[model samples]
Target chain A: MIISYFIYFKLQESDFAVTIFFMITVTEIEKLATLARIKLTDAEKQGLTKEIDSILTYIDQIKKATLDIDHTPIVGIVHNIFREDESRVLPPEDREALLKQAPEREGDFVAVKKIIAQD
Target chain B: MIDLKNLTIKKAHEDIKSGKYSAVDLTKAYLEEIKKKNPEINAYLEVFKDAEEQAQAADTRFKAGAATLLTGIPFAIKDNILIKGRRAGSASKILENYHATYDATVIEKLKREGAVFIGRTNMDEFAMGGSTENSAYGVTKNPYDTERVAGGSSGGSAAALAMDGALAALGSDTGGSIRQPASFCGLVGLKATYGAVSRNGVMAMGSSLDQIGPFAKTVTDAEIIFNTIKGNDSLDSTTISDTTYKTKKTDKKLTIGIPKAFLKGDGINKDVLKNFEESIENFKKLGYEIKDVELPNIAYSLPVYYVIMPAEVSSNLSRFDGVRFGLHKDGKDGIDDYFETRGAGFGKEVRRRVLLGTYILSSGYYDAYYNRANALRRVITSDFETAFKTVDIILTPTTPAPAFKIGEKISDPVAMYLEDIFTVTANLTGMPAISIPSGVSGKLPLGIQMTALHGNEALLFKAGKEFLKE
Candidate 1:
């Protein structure tokens, strides 16, 4: 059973001319949790459905902004700082120290569950 | 006993140089204070065991006559900024036992100055919330009033300084993290120009918005810390050199701009408004001109920040999947492992933001939300650009109100987010802003923020020194 919620945002351009609605549902929340790689219980999903709906509704005010003039995203002040291509080998002690942090480690490698399924 | 309450970095430097107190004696005093007050204030997560040794090293430098200003200065570092071999979990359970492999660039620079690091301070888990209530360890209580909170995600840093646990502290401001806490603790905080400080080795939040800054008792102390940690670094490609932005020249007296229309909006406390007016009057008496400037699209800053910040957070936090360095949980398969690990590791706010960011950056809503927010971001930057033509700096109350109770705004995420309304524009436009201690209201401290043109932190320091009469 999926519960759907709708948020109404009045566009800045002729408020009467446009009222756009975005719907967020428990199903959508589940899908988002999956994509975000976090497991949530049914109760958590339901709570997020309501909470995210309100937050999105509040932030949806950006839609009403008139960005007709040069809306290109500002990339910030500094750009295109290219450094010389260089590679340096880590010290053996440093390599051992880094490898020691992994939870499950093989000889010189971090071990993980197999992704490929076999017959 | 060292006069920790009135001790500034300059005074400490001179005292240590003049043999009034040795570096070890200073370190012992702070450690004693941390032991006495930390249990109640909950400011320090873990006081370093080698702090005395670090101070001894500083003393060695002093004996060699190679000491810098920061030598022997005890500092409290936010957990997000790494120190090699130290446990830097960012106050989250996910990385509870995780140790840093290398020093952060800022930490490296401070180490070169022979500074003594006291401990890792507490913060919001992954810096996802405005209050430190989101910390997995515990909440850092306000030093001024124990019933209330020390403003966060840099709460512990502010509380450390407010309680005289450390002479100065380092904090990362995604939006208002540093400034809000500084205001709450009656201290000065700075968020330098976005690229002015290198972000290398610091945990990534909103990549573009996060800048490591200092928390100090006075504006001059804050300026000294800023000078040491700021500069271009090859490790961080986004870093800017001294000449990255042309320095804007001003006439004899610098002009200050007040966004009157924006401040007139609702939700601002009456006391804050009164304090702001008094600040204006004080500046007027200081012989500087104040003008009302319009930021037409400035109201959109909060909404835009929500969109852009979460998007960047979703991307940046993806690295913490429990495989390489942090906590790990076992599951049926590789995919389930990620789900199980992240589900147990992340707190409520971290989960919510990651999910929201995933939703916003998802296929269907990308153009409607993320792109539109970016478009408005450009407009907001331009709004500030236009206003800077006449004003040397812009003034606003750091937070709409003083620090609230620990659980006051914890339940309501949006209400907590409103704490950054006045502080996010600096991040969006990549400007340098300083939050100086204004007069107190009731028992809580209030602060006024001054934002200068890009790469013009000198102007902010000058105005802050004048305003605080430092």
Candidate 2:
């Protein structure tokens, strides 16, 4: 009776872990290819799923290695690589040259046919 | 047996200047090679319909004494980099017919020097995946082995360089896109110190991390192109406020750092380890000391990187709606057009990243995931600071293993991500990194990667110069 209880408790723990894994999957990855405009087939999805899980597993290693979460992520001792910002006037045809490449165009503005944002 | 295909850019340039080889002749040689090998290699997305015209123009420039460093040098640029009058889709269906509004900053620079762009190369759409498998067109196979992957997201550039499709190629490295593919395809690839190259018109993945790099068969070739492209630009504010080095190489007396965390990691392949060790021994014999340095936060880069990169990607890519630019899927009337266009245009991987990015950056979870990940990104960058102190350069295996068999790790994005472990720190910390072919392991070649801090590409180039066999 005690053994059965222990097994049941462990099963529950694993099930929760799996469920959490599913949740943090960042739904953005599913749409990443679309936003980037590429296609990944179903088999590719399975491959990426397994790969992402392994990466997450390895990431879990960081929790064990460093307890200090406040440490800054960027490391060069030098403070910044900022350069002086300068605005130069683009040549007249520059915009036209670029806008011409758009599939659909409005005069002077590259015409985009649709908005991808969701409500 | 003219050995024309084996000619280096400098050698070809010399021949062209001496009138021994016309730019047209050199261009024809490459086109013939592309025609012969591209079916099996698949390096080019589209062979220029007017390659002959472009070459003739180059020959004319030579006659007029208008040749620049890249003058008449036929090369390929990754499609992500814009070129005037060329379709600039980044291997994604949504922008399948998209063209450049203007030359990308690097393209502009190269163009001034008289570089003849043969065609655009393939990539993982939006420079997302480490392998070219994510492309909507088709997977770019390894040049070394047709059945294996040429590491991406710059696979096409690497493939083109390895098989002599171009004298040199340009690719963007957003997290090992340039270096890893160079490793898989046995070529030299460099990710300039962040902002060292202008990002004026390049499609961004993670703006903070994206860098334009070069692909070539030799370190010198890579350095030549790097020299031509590197400089401070008023166009990009993030470029090093001050330039790093005037020349492409650094003086010796440099300290090389080898991160223990990576050298002793779990996923490292045996042959990769062996080649890396052998190359280190050669370097030591050349009088450089290899010190063991520890960057503890290095291990967590992927999660932080994936989270932050996609979050930024979700934001940067928000512009590609069906309404304004790119491939439009016609819908009933026009309203459904928006829905169907993006829905049909974007591929699965692209959608996944966008959606994953969307979730992370969403209001409720932004602090825990996106903000925390950004904090971790700082931590990862800081860790590099502590390590770069005692060393001028860091060396590691470019990939955990050589080119994996096609479909071996394609299904597992995490495993594929792991393949980029050795190369990501460069992106994370905004350091310059280069991958150089060390030697062949089995049927494939292994790459040795070295990195230098901001404005220190000279060290990478200097080190890369010693290993050239040509």
Candidate 3:
């Protein structure tokens, strides 16, 4: 499997004609997980590193796709749809219903983790 | 007892109108079947308690002479779609208790027509995976062979219809979510054009690729359900009026396009290819011409889709933060709260896509991955445009192979994504496609897919009806 990866990596390098050396290490996976705001366990991080490496190797073929069209217009639902910027008040019952979905609520306000603190 | 298996929407409507049976009776028959089969199949996450009440209302409409064709029909809804006062969990523990405060535009339209919803069907959590195995609830088993998957993110919708648990069901297609499962379960599934159906109430996966559609036992039944639920809704600005795409009935001589380069690939299963050829022969018997066509950029569709879809998924699913609704995990800090809540809430496949999407859209690699894929997406769209000028519809196998065992491809995400190879092109191009049961290999059924130009569903339905005649 390691040999296969090396050959595939070399082929991708030549196929896409890009000059960057690449390997999806565990540290990189941890960075991406952080960027995505999802915490992964140590074991999950290792497993995902191997899986993402294989996935990236497979999808690397897209870099090799030859495109003759510089910019073909996207073909569906391109019309500009505008709506009026307006505020509407919800009924009391509806307001209660919406507020009820919050994990924590104080009166009519949804409670959240605080970011600002007095020094 | 009503012969629910052989019942179509038209026959059911006629029977109700003629007083042969009431809507209450029909709903009871389906609810009874759900009770019997749902435990084993796990097709439905929750069967609605108000089904019979709604059917009674439909009976009132029929008596008042205000009945539409769907007035007394029972349909299954995928869990992602919001029906007010009902739970719409999307088969994830995060939203297992979330209830919609308002009905989706489609649900409102169906309600006006007096349709009965039996239950919310199970799905892949947040509509992430191909097989229903990724569902936080449980896997939906194929009715034909219980050991295998029902094929999803719309597996429950298709499985319920396949087992005659519901007369029809609604499903959303982001990639092959609808058609592939329909193919696997021997049902008809349609992925309508991008903006053809309003997405006001359906859960968003990939915004540009997702469209809600129907799954049923027959082509005509699928068409009827589609027509009832489709139309422009002012709430969803992306919707278009019926006249947006000028549709006309076709004559007997209809031309079908076959992308030889795509089908010529050795990766496709032989049984699937054989079944496709037999379908071609069947079309010839119907006096239609089958011609070879080229879609040069077609081979890149799956790769392009992986890039664009994950990017969109990451953006759309960002709304699931612990603040407003759904699961919340308290932590040491605000950022930790965000991390652990989402970490535990989302399924394994959902997390992978989100992270992959983040990687692609991040600064350094953005142009190399996401931007490149978007430009290639244009190439794919135009290929369909050029091909449609020559043929009314394009044909391919719905899946590369039939449904594999439950845990067959789960470990390797790439292998599971490959199952969508033949079906994602339509989504990438924003075109309408349908999958119909063509034939069977061994004990498993195979499906043949037909795609048409934007707003050309009339042609797809026309051809689909003729193809299924045998």
Candidate 4:
């Protein structure tokens, strides 16, 4: 709805601390909100702009650390998992129980707003 | 009337078996304390109505001569962990009325042992923030001081234990969620080695960093609970067995390493450093060698964690699209419906991470931000591996300071994230770490944290027990 109408813009270098006006534009935040699938009020966007700037600035320190070592092995515990090609469906009772929690349910199915609508 | 304050799982089991107190009686004692303190502390979001029924079942098991150590024990569970037929909302409104249809792997294990669950405790919404102030229900106040925060995203579980509301509680650590709270509340908290415990039913935060561990009054209790829940599960393929990261049992005293970089920083409180030094001296008195170890990449842990965690958070949280379950907000179109549901459902902190993660993983920025962070993650993790060769354990203060006033860091996201600086290294490296109460700094509790090589939790428990004695 509101998120889809917001246009995504390219992040220009001027987006950072170049000028007070260039700090974080509403267009940039709208793009991020659309990508994250969350609608932000104008007030929320203004607040987020400031918060995200500081968080990004803090995390920017990682770029300074040199990645001098080649082939940095992925952390120790990562392993490939292989399972048998078998199909196991949830029991009927459990299926019903889970379906009961859906916000919009119609008979045996969970309903949702139509996705094919054109603007 | 059973005494809830001094109760331990071991003592509770003995008293139950000796006819000193029944399981129902023990459960009732904790329930009474929960009723008394939960109103003010807000530790438990909802105390289960079936608590008495669970205790009754445990009592029946004890009567039939089928009691295990955890058979009659009562526990408070962090709301993020699923328990069949119960609400596990992760302190967010999206799942406010959602009921779990099946038990989490750990819940199934505990159920098989007949452990009585007292209630679901509060946490930061989606386990995103460092303070329980992010909880949709409300902030969980520190039991020691109501004006201050109980460190989070597992703050409720820590507060529950601190107030004797539950015997022990289960908490998930993505990055210092469990340990920092335990440190704040003055309890023993453990973050098991990555994949040492299955995360099949826990709310996904950062998949690479998530782990389930326990909060207890004593190190022995934490170990017992850890051993009961830890094992490779078919449901969670990432889990590993004790044999995977085995360490040789040495007769020589264990060597404790201190990364000098984290010890004397500008933000670190002087009292915290004092407690850490006293803990080091305690280890030396116990005949362990204290050595200064250099972990060059350890300093970059926070930035690496910030980048990597949000990337995973954005990906893992995509499942809440309002079509399947949880909250659903009607809109003119499908896309609008998603925006409305998520925007209204998630708390402010959850939305912050989701958006931050999206930006990091989006096109044109992935290589510059996310990839570089991943490379740094590898450097940080391998550095710990190298350090472990020279030292059996690494020690530090659990947090830079004790519990802060409730509104202190809420406005500053970076300031709140700094709480995890000491604890995130263990999660990054897949190593087990424990936070044991050192003493009090002023009215607030202080904790000394120790991290060991992957699957070397036995060393933590042994050292924690020896250190706690002093």
Candidate 5:
């Protein structure tokens, strides 16, 4: 198993005997920064760890009153679709613009690092 | 004193075309209205400086007898939708400096139809949270009450429409983002059939569930915008135009279905139930049949949406590497500082979902979580297919309750999730659903949600128009 540092912490409180635990996984701390596409320093990670732990603790407390997952049912309101078969192309400029965002654009294609090394 | 603010798009368009009013004149009036109302409503993040220029162009088009139904109409789009040369932040600090390099497909289509994009509206950061409070920029206030939250992640879109800042606003829905916010703000919002509108340019929250739709004060405006943008595009392979047919009519007997399972849900509010029941009576009065139906599989939607949405989110958002786009935070002074960049850039909620998604789709847990959710989604889809055979459409409360105060449920994500119970089913099954204003007596407005099978969006439009008439 590939394991990374992810931890959770307590957060805030409420009434009605409902729990309010807000745990932040260590992996989440790592991942969140990745999403913002920002880099984090070791000291900041340490700070976030404390903050997430506290948040999780609060969330856990409120959730204590609610029934566990097995007890409650899931529900939704949308339905199935069977769409018509059709082919339409986006304008050339749109196609080209999307391709332009790629790190490497080669001859109307988005060039990527070769995933599989050729034998 | 006539309330031009209350005019529908059809009426406004007719008036504009007949010289009773000019598109430029209408745009100026609305611009003034936005200037008056925006500060208190907090519905707009930025009003376009080019708005007057665009209005001039629209007026010029109208005078030349080249006005399409949407000519010169000022509309604010959720900040997520890419407009060429404009900032599309997705309400996150990370993308604060990133300008949209190109217009999204919807923007292109709307621009072609002569719709003026007045500016960008706020949203939950990367469309993560149930309330606009999660926005990194700042919370978008509810139009009815400034202190209360506008429901999200498309909260600002709904608020813009509610506050009369724009005639209609573009919003993207993944799960209940559009409908729930529309319900809270007393506007019309739609999540079109999966793949109905191309998801080419917007910052995506979930690949399978994400869709670009509209929020308008009236149903017809929603229809007008939907018609203008709905089509198949090769850029987004998922979108298809199954039913090229379109019209809004309620002349015959239409069957409306209500899931028996939802009637007994633990989280449904009593006021919501009352509002929904009244809508049912109104539908009956309008000569429609309402029936009770059962779909035991409906319960799995939230878990499924959460599972699938996060997985896709983790994938789609991978492109925002600090080296390439938006805010770049350098840590440890090297290329690998990318991790630190995201750590500093994303908000707490966006991070949580990314981790949850990565964990669920990981090597060992994929089958147990992601695969199981996919199987459950199929069951949910089948259940809807079965119901549609018996009824023309299904009607439920858009959200389980009305707007909750800013801090009311922010502490408990699971409890706050109850607000999406009525809307997730549509996302899970890739169906078209609309939230329409049911009634409003005091500050709070109530909503009735209607869902139809794929490609049956025309039926939804017809049904929605009928509801508005009542």
Candidate 6:
């Protein structure tokens, strides 16, 4: 089922003004789930479609915000901290301990399903 | 008996030093309380087996006359913070049975001070929800009213302290997680200025917004924990030193600002508002100047935070791809393997956020949503900067109301998100904020949050101590 979600954006100009409607649907949700690399059940997809639509509508209020100043997001007080490049090796036991937490491991390496296929 | 209910870290330290009781005795008292109250509260996921041993070491330190303020104190650590060789899942099935390979920087620092690790507390899965109901293990019930929820994603830490299961606890706040639960449990919680505390070894969620903080019975205890855990670390370059931001000179009496326009909005509980007014009056009586300040762009904080946090979460959580550690499920192909594993590993709320983040950062929506939100974030931050010019700190109710019932707002994500309205502004502005118990609403506890300018935690500490009369 396709659910039409409309996000209204009002744009103002000296000579003209207009409202733009953006539609989000189940197809977009499926694409998002794929992009996020999470498999969603059919029910979750349906529920999330409605939930995401509502959240989008709520957040759409930002579109009407007028940006009169230019500023980057303030991450923290300190910025551009440069550290010297150094190579440090973990002790063998510490490396082993870290590798031990892996679901599947072989020797010192984490094991995964074969990626490249051959004829 | 240790009189655990009336215990503070300073008093406990003095008692341990005066030989009133050994550190082992204190650890055992907390362990016994955990055994008794944990079943009902579900505060702790696993009580550390070596708690007594750790406390015994503290006793050794006392004998050597090397005891610090936190020495011999038993602490409940939030599951998201790593303690070497202990299970440190962020209360999610994805990381179930995972053990930490190294101690978090805060844990390492606490160990140096001879603090005892009682256990790891429960939290919302990946610190995602506003209530502990999202925990994979079980919901942590409020110690005051078991029928109600312990506010989350740091719910277990708050519940643990409220129940006297530990002397103090650690919790990470991303959009009110620490303060909300602290308010609900009648505790003092501090989310220090961003980068004041290192994030190394703590699980990432909203990298820009996440901050590891303390849940303590008193404002003084919270300050003690914050001082110990905060510093510049080589591992987390985002950490700050004492000299990071130039100190702001303040007058003899601190001036408190109330954003009247913002507080005039809808949905605030009447009792909470009444309690907030009472707190303002108390501040006045204490000789602190109270002023009305304007934060014109503050109303857009929540919307902007919802945009920026999820975008960061999507980028930060991509590391848990089922290849290296934690829970993994196999599928027909390599790509299918990740899909299957994450699908089975993550819970509903985690999945919802990942998808929402993807959509927000996706092409076409990136400029309109993410970039626009970042621009608005700066404006909102500047609003606080402007307000602080006239006021030393800003005050607001920690949450809109007291703790809600377990299943109350779980079904409605927006309602749950609304609980962080007053708390998120601090995170967005990268300022230090503390939530202290103001009064009680009905049977539940209420809190008043005080936010100070970036790198001005001393002002917050002073004002909090004054307000709590600590």
Q: What TM-score would every model get versus the actual structure?
A: 0.96, 0.85, 0.95, 0.95, 0.82, 0.96
Higher-scoring candidate on TM-score, 2 or 5: 2
For model 1 the local lDDT of residue B33 reads 94
RMSD of each: 3.4, 6.2, 2.8, 5.8, 7.9, 3.5
Listed for every candidate in order, the interface RMSD values in angstroms are: 6.4, 9.0, 4.4, 10.0, 11.4, 5.9
- Give each model's clash number: 0, 62, 0, 1, 51, 0
Query: For residues A6-27, could you state the per-residue lDDT of candidate 6 as single tens digits?
Result: 1111211122324344467889
**TM-score of chain B as predicted in candidate 1:** 0.99
Off by over 4 Å in 1: A1-23, A69-71, A84-86
In model 1 chain B, the worst 10-residue window by lDDT is B261-270
Q: Show model 2 residue runs off by greater than 4 Å.
A: A1-20, A24-119, B241-249, B332-336
| lDDT, candidate 3, B1-470, per-residue tens | 89987898989999999999999999999999888999999999989898999999999999999999999789999999999888888998778568888898888888888899999999999888888999999999998889999899999998898888889899999999999999999989999988888999888999889999999888999998889888888877778777887664576588999998677645678899899998998998998889999887787788889998999999988888888888899988778888989999998999899888888889987877887888999888889889988888899999988888999889989888888888999999988999999989887889999999888898899999988881
**Top model number, DockQ:** 3
**Cα lDDT of model 1 by residue, A29-54, tens digit:** 98898898999999999888888887
DockQ of each: 0.43, 0.18, 0.45, 0.33, 0.11, 0.42
Q: What share of the true interface contacts does each candidate keep?
A: 0.68, 0.24, 0.59, 0.66, 0.14, 0.65
Between candidates 3 and 4, name the one with more favorable lDDT. 4
lDDT of 1 by residue, B247-280 (tens): 8764369899999877764478888989999999
Ranking by lDDT: 1, 6, 4, 3, 5, 2
Lowest lDDT 10-mer window, candidate 5 chain A?
Answer: A1-10
CAPRI verdict (incorrect, acceptable, medium, high) for model 4: acceptable
- Score residue B457 of candidate 6 by CA lDDT: 88
Candidate 1 residue A23 Cα shift, in angstroms, is 4.3
